[model samples]
Target: MAGPLAGIRIIELAGIGPAPFCGMMLADHGAEVIRVERIGGRIQATDPLLRSRRSIAVDMKSPEGVALIRDLAKDADGLIEGFRPGVTERLGLGPDILLGDNPKLVYGRMTGWGQTGPYAQAAGHDINYIALSGALHGIGRKGEKPVPPVNYLGDFGGGGMMLAFGMVSALLAVKNGADGQVIDCAMTDGSALLTAMTWGFRAAGMWKDEAGTNLLDGAAHFYDSYECADGRFIAIGSIEPQFYAQLREALGLTDDPDFDAQMDAGRWPALKEKVASIIASKPRDHWCEKMGHTDICFAPVLSMAEAPEHPHNAARGTFIEVAGTTQPAPAPRYGGTPTDAPTPPPQAGRHSDDLLGRCGYDEEKIADLRKAGVIA
Candidate 1:
C-alpha cells in the first residue's frame, strides 16, 4: 500500500541543500516528487541524502523548458524551490505563474534570510543564517567562540524541514477548501522559531543571556559531557534532585558537599571538575555497566558509526542500509500506514524521459525537447 501522502504531487526546482532535502522528505512519505534539474545536471552523484525523487533536466532559460515546467505545475499539488529572491520569477516559473495554472498548488520557497529582507539578496551560507537568527549566539561554551553546529541547525533542520512542513500544511488546507498560498520558509526565521522555548525561558527570568551558562546549555554540572579513562566520552543529565542523588550514589559522590548544591552557579566549575575527575577514573564501558539504564540519565557518547549498531537504535530500526551505505530511516513511526524508503538515489536526469512522459509530454515531444537542447 502507498504511504499516507500517496496522492500528493510535488515539483522540486533543484538547487542545493535545503531544496533537495525538502524534496527527499516529500518523496519518502509517498509524494510523487519530480526534481527539475538544470540542463547540465549540476548535482553531485554520491549524495545519499538526496535520495527518493525522479529527475528531469531542463534548460529553464529556454522558452520550451519553461513551458514544460508550467505544464508539470498544472497538475502538481506543491512546488518547492530554493533560490535567491526573484530567481524563479526571472526564470518564468515563479509562484504567480505556477499557482495561476494550479490554484490549489502550494508554492514553497526555501531560503536563508527569506524572500523579502535586507539579507535576502545577499549571498549567505547555513552558518550566516543561523548566526543572524540568534541560534549560534546561544550554542557554545561561555567565553569561547560560537560553534557552527555543522549545517544541521539552519540548512536541514530549519530550512528544509520547515519548508516541508509548510508545504504539507498548505496542502492540507487546500484539501479542506482553502486556496493555496506561497510559503516563505526562511532558515533564519525557522531557526529563530526553533529557539522559541529558550526565548520563553529568557523572558521568565530562568535563562541567562550568555551561552553555555544555562541548565540545558551545559552551565549546570548535571548536564554535560565527561571524558573517561579510555579517552571516550559520556553524557550526564541528572537534572532532578532524585536523579542527581541517584547519580551521586552510583558514582560514590555522596560525601562531597559541593556536589550537593545542584543549582549553585558559583560551584558548577568545581563540581564539573570533580565529576570529570571521578568519571575519568573509570573507562566509558565501566561507567555504562554501572549506570546504564538508570534514572541517572547517563549514556556513552557514541559516534555515527556506533549509533546505528547501538542496541536501542538497532531495536527500533532507526537506521537502514541503502546502496551499501548506512543512513537513518524515515522517522516518526506510524501505526497503520508505515513509511518506506524509495528507490536508490538516481543519476542526474536518469528519469528524464519517464518524468517528462508523466508530465503529459509524449515521446515525440520529449525527443523534440532533447533534440532542441531544451532538456537533457
Candidate 2:
C-alpha cells in the first residue's frame, strides 16, 4: 500500500517555514504534493521540511503562471499557502478562484494572525505570534525573560500541524460528498489551543500563572533538569509520592526531613539546591546508570546529535537516513498503512516539464513558456 493518503494530492504554494512543513507531512503519508516555487529558486536541501515532494517552478507574478496554478489546483485534494492574507488573492490564486475550479478543494491558509484581526496584516514571526497568544509567557524561569523555544511552538507544532489537520479533515469531508471550504489557520489561535491544559490548570487553581512556579515548570525540584559533573544534564520527574521516595532513596536522602514536605513551595528552593548539588557530583552517564532502571523518573539530557543514536530511539527507528541526512521518521505509526520512506527534497523546477505535461500543457507550449520566462 502507498500509505493512508495514497490517492490524495496537495498543491503547495511554496513558502518558508510552516507551510512547507504541512506539505512535508502530507507527502510523507503518501500524498502527491506539488510544490510551486519561483522560476529561479532552489530548494534548500538542508531544510527537512521541504522533503518528500515534487517541485514546479513558475513566475507566480505572471498571468500564465497563475493560470497554471489554478489548473493544477483544479483537481487537487487540498491547497496550502502561507502568504499574508491578501497576497494569494492579489496573485489571483486565492480560495475563491481555486475553489471555484475545484469545488471540492480544501484551501488552507496559514498566518501568524488571522485574516481580519487587529494585527492580521502586520508582519510577525513565530515569537511574535506565540507572544500574543500567551504561550511564550509561560516558557521561561520566573526571574528571566521568556526564552523562545526555537520557534517550534508557533511554527511547526501549532501552525503547520494545525493546517495539516485542517487539510485532512476537509479532504475527509470531501470524500463524504461535502463541498470544500476555506480553513483560516492562525498560529496565534493554534498556540493558544496548545495551552489548553495550562488554562484548565489555572482555572482549577492547580497551576500558577507565572512561568517557573508551576508543577511541570523548572521551579519544581522533582520535575526539572539538573546539571551534572561534566556539564551535561538530566531530567527528573519523580512527581508521585512513590516515585519521589525512589528518588530520595537513590540519592541516599530517604531519612532527610528537609525533603519531607514535597509540596511546600517555601522548601522548593532549598530542596532544588540540594538536588542540584547531588546531581552535579556525578556525571550524567553515572546517574543514568544508577537510576536508569529504577522509578526515579530519569533521563539524560541529549542534544540533537545524540538523540537519534540513543538506544531507545534507535530501537524504535524513530529517526531514519534520508538522502544522507538523518531526519525524523514518519510519526504515529500506522498498523495497516505503513508510510514509505520519505524522498529527499527536489530541486526547484525539477518536475516542471512533467508536471506541465500532466496538466495538459504540451511540450512546445512548455518550451515556449520557459523561453518566455514564465516557467523554469
Candidate 3:
C-alpha cells in the first residue's frame, strides 16, 4: 500500500477470468483488494492474474457468509464481481444492497454482455463477445475464418481493463462528492469501444470491412511479418514514408520500381510476395543485424521464451520473478509513488483472522464463527 490507491480497499467477489484480472490490477497498483472466495475454494497460485491479493474463504450461500461480506462492504471504497447479471443479486450482494449501506462505494460488474441486454444472461466467451461487437468480423485473412486473439481483446482488454478504469473513475467521482454508482462493464461494449479507432478509419473510407485488407491489418507489404530462411519471422511496420524509405534502403530495394510506389494498395500482394522472397533468403538474425536499430521498423518476432531476455525488455525490467514465476510487471509507471513489487498470491483465507479482526470481529467472536464453519 504505497502507490496512489494505497488506502483504497476493494472487496472482490471471487470469480474466474476478467473479474479476477481486474482485482489483480487494482491490487498491483497498491489497492488492498480482499478476495472473498467460497469455503474451501482455491485460485491457482500460479495464475499471475490473482497476484498480490489476500483471500478469505466463506460459505457464500450461508446467511453468516452473506453478513460477513456485508460487514466488510461497510468500509470498502469499491466492490468488483464477474458473475453473470443476476448472480450477485441472487447472493443478496447486488449494488442496491451494498450501495444502500456504503453510499460512496463504486460497484463494478464485469460480464460478457451487459446487465439488461437480450444476451445479458447468455453463456459466452471472448470470441463470442468480440464477434457480437463486430471486432471479429474484420480480423482474419481474406477467405479465412476469423482467428481469435486468444481472449486478449474481450477478456482482459475489454472486460478486466475496462472494469479497472471504470472503478478508479468512479472512485474519483466519489472524491468529487458523487454518490456510489454501478458500472456495467460488458465485454461486448468494451470490445466495441476498443475498436473506436478502426471504426473511425472505416467511417473515413480508409478501412475495409473485409478482414486482412486494411493498411495495418496485414494487407500492406511494408506493415506485415515476413518469414526468414531459418523459418523464424520478423515484423516490419514501415508505415510512414520515411520509415518505408528506410526499409527500402536497408533491403537495397531503393532502385526497384515495384517497391517505389509504396502506397499503391492494389500492388500490395505482388510486392509482398517479392519482399517475402527477399526476406526468406536471409535468416531472422541477418535482418536484425542489418536494420535492428534503424528507422526501418524492423525486429525479429521473438517468442515468449525469448521476449523477456531481449535487451530492451531486460533494461526496462518489463518482466519480474514472483513465486519463481516470470510475468509482466505492474504497468503505467507512477512517478512520485512508484508501486512496490507485488507479493505472491497467498493461500485462500490465509489472512482470515487478520482480515476479520479489522472488520470489528474480536478473537472470541471469530473463533465462534470458525467453529460454526462460517469462515475459513
Task: Write the residue-wise lDDT of candidate 1 on 175-205 in tens digits.
Answer: 9999989999999999999999999999999
> Which candidate's TM-score is highest?
3
Clash count, one per candidate: 0, 0, 0
lDDT of 3 at 341: 94
> Ten residues in a row with the worst lDDT in model 3?
38-47
CA displacement after TM-score superposition, residue 159 of candidate 3 (Å): 0.8
Cα lDDT of candidate 2 equals 0.92
The C-alpha stretches of model 1 lying farther than 4 A from their native spots are 42-45
Query: In model 3, which residue pairs have backbone atoms overlapping below 3 Å?
Result: none
lDDT string, candidate 3, 1-376, tens digits: 6788999999998988999999989998999999998888876777899899988988888888899999999999999999888888998898899999999999999999899879988999999999999999988887799999999999999999999999999999999999989999999999999999999999999998999999988999999999999999999999999999999888889999888888899999999998899999999999999989999888889999999999999999999999899899899789898998988888989888999999999999999989999998
Which structure is stronger by TM-score: 2 or 3? Answer: 3
Q: Model 2, 1-376: lDDT tens per residue?
A: 1689999989999898999989989988889999999988988786789888989998999999999998889878899999999999999998888888989999999999988889999999999999999999999998889999999999988899999999999899999999999999999999999999999999999988889988888888899999999999999999999999999999889999999999988789899999999999999899999999788888989999999999999999999998889999988789999998888888999999998898899999999999999988
- 1 versus 2: better TM-score goes to: 2
Q: Which stretches of candidate 3 lie over 4 Å from their true place?
A: none
TM of each candidate vs. truth: 0.97, 0.98, 0.99
Compared with the true structure, model 3 gives a TM-score of: 0.99
- Model 3: lDDT of residue 62: 86
Model 3's lDDT to the true fold?
0.92
